[model samples]
Target: MTTIKNSPRNLAVTVLERINRQGAYSNLELNQVLKRHQLTVADKHLLTTLVYGTLQHQLSLEYWLQQFTRRKLDPWVKQLLLITLYQYHYLERVPAFAATNEAIEIAKWRGNAGIRKFVTGVLHAALKSGWPDFAAVSDPIQRISLTSSLPAWLVKQLAAEYDLATVAAIGQAINEPARLSIRVNRAKASLAQAQAQLAAEGVQTQPSHVAADGLIVQSGDLLGSQAFAQGIVTVQDESAMLAVESLAQVCDLSQATLVLDACSAPGGKTGQVAAALTKPASQVVALDIHDHKVKLIQKNMARLGLATRVSARQGDARQLAFLADGSLDAAVVDAPCSGLGLLRRKPEIRYQKTFRDSQRLHEIQLAILAAVAPKIKKGGIITYSTCTILKEENDQTVAAFLAAHPNFALEKTQTARALKADRAAKTLTILPSDYGSDGFFIATLKRVE
Candidate 1:
């Protein structure tokens, strides 16, 4: 018998219980557990699948559990049942008997015989009855919420912002697995050179329709490939790579052009800016609030051999006393947002965030823009961006900033022909359903004064 602590099913329960009860971020908690344990590749893959799959469909799993049992279940018991049900309904590769047996073993190890019997009965009953019809739910919003595993508030909010059809599409898209993408570093190699190098190293690639320098990974170990090891490419979503590309359209990257990455951390955008610089004198100042994250930016820069092009610092975005007024040629305000746009990558955010959180982030975003506004030279561009699709955090925040600062004006943003991005407004909002990339918003503001 596998030890309780070593069993993959048992570990999934522990991770899920922590996330459900303590509000832990699924990616962070899951990674932490994986690092602490010595597990085989197959075991790690199973653990990841169980954790993400269960969280992705939690609302529906709980809804199903409610149909079979009316009793208030313990947190662990509830989590165990949820993962078991996820395997039954979603994971067709797993035999039903194997899922049931593994779940019962985990229950017996974690609890007494009474609990074991209860879990066994619920699994048997659910197997016999099959999934409940969501059509029976009367409220359109509630039905969408349960079926999509989105919160009622989120479903309603999306519905208010978009039509029911669009909302339903977004709900369906975010539950799908996130794609793995990497940006080819043009400073070191062209897209073709990078692709050839990656292929020689056993990784396969396909061009991204959303970003010119982006590639959607098809197969093989990207992280272990020589192209990644030697910094010929770096992992970044196609949508995220667009923010810097949009900035490049309005701002010159010639020698001696100084830019500020106001909220850069782990240095993805900062690295992109560095790679786009035309001469050695062109540089980026990357700032983050935490010291460790500042070091992370520095580490990434050194890894990419772009250390000389970026100056990593720890500071708040709302304050700019260290820099003189109108000193920067351009700025990137990738403001900290509610992360509503990253639902496909971080499913737990749908349950963790609220509409009010976006409202509060709006205030902070405006302040950061205000601080960075004075730092940009006349006719300079400030590229504001976020990983959230909410208008309050995207367009509304930009509108509010422009209203408060008459000196600044919104500029039309253009992406590559391949992206075929929406041009209805100066700002661009890319939904998850648009191109299967992380949802993002980008707005360019020019300082005219």
Candidate 2:
């Protein structure tokens, strides 16, 4: 086993290299790197800023870089230049000379004289040229794409659905850091109790405006706190929690109820559902397609002390042969989409996802909904949700579902109250810019028989 020396620049470079060359996910790789190395608070901040900022702005950075050098550079060299340019353009506190010197030093340590010279030349050239004027791009979609560091395809798609100004605002909103929100585990502690516990440990938090059991952590190391370790609180975005809460609002789970989380893995919402159920003798069965994910759900449930309430199962959500029709009291389908809503947290998704991916996911989402719709009892609730603002996946999918199955109707009143959702032909869409949360769409439907 080998370990890289623990320096902010080295750690950032290593993470960036893997992401750029090996197609690694930014958040997962960053967590693994942070756990393996001991870094000071300042270094941790610097490493995170560099990795996310560089990836988020890579497209714009590359567009700028092409102005200076048309030569094809090695991936590592490109990563070095990207981070250097990111600091030059974004981090006003870091002087251009210091950023250039750090890049040169990193190059010398990691590469030969030729590479060092190449890096130095690129940095000097970029500094001399200054930033590109995005206004110079004539096309609105292309200009927004370059300025916001979003893909042109995504920009065009969003622009077609919304006005160009709204698309640009959405793009700009996702580039900023996401706010931290956590769900207080009511089974273990009250929201007020959890807030006091977190405050005693130097972590300040406020109640979430949307979720009844949610608290927004203003500042603190939440993961390292006792509240999190002991399951007094669980890290969850307000939008994700609201999806599960929306189901609870319309469903009658006050008796001995059986609920199903159709695609529950790494079960954040499963825990929320389990805790929100008012029935004393209720059961929440969480199912995932893969065995490892089932285990992950089970492990998360155990940590939150929800294992006894929520059972984990491994099966294809598209085929639930074991459960009979109209057996479940309620169901939640947090279907997989392109993850466009999570760009703030997962900055690399903009480059990785495509419009085609959303098309493919729509089929899968409809299949899961078809399979689970029959499982809910008459008059029971089925909440379809996705972490994307795209209409194709949200309203369009639900519209297709309703057209096929007239037995279920949208529970518009409940969804509006729970999500503060705008009614869009029978569904709700929560945009990140509008809600100040993840871009989530949730539609609650009731089996009318």
- Candidate 1: misplaced stretches above 4 Å? 418-422
TM-scores of the models, in the order given: 0.98, 0.95
**Tens-place lDDT digits, model 2, residues 1-449:** 22335777767888998987788999899999999888878888899999999988889999999987889887778888888899999999988887888788888888889999988988888888899999999998899999889998898888888789888888888888888999999888998899999999989999987777888999888999998998899999988887777776676555637999999988988898887667667889899999999999988888898888898999999999899898998888999898899998888888888898999999999999999988988888888999998888988899899999999998773442345544454566777787678898888888999
User: How do the residues 1-449 of candidate 1 rate in per-residue lDDT, one tens digit apiece?
Assistant: 44767878889999999997899989999999999888888889999999999999999999999988989889999999999999999999999999999888888988999999999999999999998899999999999999899999988988888778887888899999999999998889999999999999889999998999999899999999889988889999999999999988778766436999999998899999999887757789999999999999998888888999998999999988988899998999999999988998899889989999999999999999999999999989999999998888999999999999999999888886435545668888889988889999999999999
Residue-level error in angstroms, candidate 1, position 259: 0.4
* Candidate topping TM-score: 1
**Poorest stretch of ten by lDDT in candidate 2:** 413-422
Residue 182 in candidate 1 has what lDDT? 96
Clashing pairs in 1: none
